[model samples]
Target chain A: MNAPLPAAVDWPLAVHQALSRLGFGVIGYVPDAGHKRLIELCHGDARLRTVVLSTEEEGIGLATGAWLGGAKTALLMQSSGVGNIVNALGVVRECRIPLLLVVTMRGEYGEFNPWQVPMGQATPEVLRAMGVLVQRADTADEVAVQVDAAARIAFGGYAAAAVLISQRVIGIKSFQEQAAQ
Target chain B: MSALRRREVVRALLVNRGDLLVVAGLGSTAWDCAATGDHPLTFPMWGGMGCAAVTGLGLALAQPARRVLVVTGDGEMLMGLGSLATIGVQRPANLSVVVIDNERYGETGMQKTHTAHGVDLAAMARAAGFASAVLVREASAIESLRQAVHHGAGPHFAQVKVVAEKEAITLPPREGTLLKNRFREALLGASASLQ
Candidate 1:
């Protein structure tokens, strides 16, 4: 007898739900295709305040302010945006402010954009160098667990933590796919 | 209208401040805030240049009942111009951003900034959708600015034009950890370290 295929997991929805469960009242983000569902979910939720950022660095400031005001907050961004936020991360790390970053990875596993590779490969190390605890989720099933753990460590411990969602889970966009579109 | 004195302007703004959390940008603005009086609620950044306004936004969002003010310089405000738009959309009523437009980068030896080239920060803030955005060129207009900072329904933005001149530096506590802890203690009291 043939076994049934496992159910397809919706990682974005799962992550969004996890953030809500974790008591994040504010979500600051720069738009990315990988985060479409999560962004939509946040926008529709009346309890959550969604902020669209022009640069990733602004999200850091927004999250910092939100925390200071006694609200739990999260920042959502793509890996490429990580480069823009290194300096701002100092405020979070040095001040011992709790922060949750959900980053969608690019330039790995059949990536078409060469520009994204350097930052994508360097993201974890960069965050680590800045004193952020880094966690990874390669499969859809791991999304909720990793995000939940990161949220706990960040808010409960008053420290910075990041959950990097791999490109494989987000479905890598190849050059051919872009050309076809 | 002649440019107002920054030190006096800052002092005036904070004269009646009560339970207000302040996030000061680096250099001159930080010094101005320190000169007024150091309080546990004051968080003065030593190096984070463009993060002050957003930092105030976070503090305001975290404590909706308390007012959060961000006092920053022109160069710093230009560096973080995008923050206005973010604040515009979020519209945190308790948050206010006051940009001290000396029109120069005072820390870097008085180099001219974009504001000197006629950049209108208040207009930018207005365009970005702040509930109230004003330019305070005259000292006579300060009372309205004060009202906006303290009791106005906002995300308010104000660009206070001041003469580009050096003043005695009044540095606040330098240790980031100490500042953070004190702020947390002042806000959360005994439960600050509970987490």
Candidate 2:
């Protein structure tokens, strides 16, 4: 287990540093508000390639491909994206592909929208059922630290692991909140 | 011209393969690739339904020096049509995706796929901005496809119409881990044994 980086006290910055330190070759993600800052940070650094995916499930295949080509990879998505990843994870699991997923929660803890609830609630259980190790992070510092630890476990042993950034830490989304951007 | 043979098209593409990395989609395409000859560099998807193209895309992006090819059926290709859009946006010059369009789901009792009803996958790929998108209905044109796939500067796409007939089920090694590790070892050498 790795300790939280000095930058871990913050948020998206902390998560970004964790991925950077691990030397991830590729980062696959769909458009996500919770992951917007992190995704932007990972883009075009020369150290890694951040791919814009059509769907979350595509990220699973992308990660698998990267690994097979001797490159390390990770996926960033909202919990809703986890549902799209259900069948795709079977490839990663059965193939023993080293994978790390960083997911941001949307349905719990001050969720303004009800629709995100069903899939968000099922995210962890769904991943666990698919033979993925799940670790949830409730605080800003915990999120990146867990991502780093999970990545180590995954890449070290050719396993799949995910760090779910809890909704509380990711901040609540509302129409008014959208007013700023 | 009538439909071409699936195994022949796959065999033609893989003849002097050299260093081309292949990702075969589930069902018949996998069997077709296996029917030719099993190799460590060729990953036949026993499970992932529509991921072969994107999987090849990932490899293409990672190893920009190596050409990656994806062989998938029309049904599997249709299932992940969104991947074409994604590939279009990325446009890795080293990737080529070929759909063995039998117009039917050969593995599942020959149910007609979208291609059977006049769906043009090559046109879709062209719209998706592939450098080369051709619907190969003739064996004579396969030489050009092989040239484009192996040597052209492109994210290429070709939907080769094939006869919807069953071939011998040439099953490759089904163990995913072994397939993965062997591919890694072949591609990455000692580094594969490490992580």
By TM-score, the best candidate is 2
Candidate 1 chain B, which ten residues in sequence have the lowest lDDT sum? B186-195
- Runs of candidate 2 exceeding 4 Å displacement: A1-8
DockQ (CA atoms), all models = 0.66, 0.74
Error of 2 at A147 (Å): 1.0
Question: Would you give me the overall lDDT of model 1?
Answer: 0.86
**Ten residues in sequence with the least summed lDDT for candidate 1 chain A:** A1-10
**Residue A77 in candidate 1 has what lDDT?**
93
Error of 2 at A91 (Å): 0.6
Give residue A99's error in model 2 in angstroms.
Answer: 0.7
TM-score of 2: 0.96
The most accurate candidate by lDDT is: 2
Off by over 4 Å in 1: A1-7, A175-181
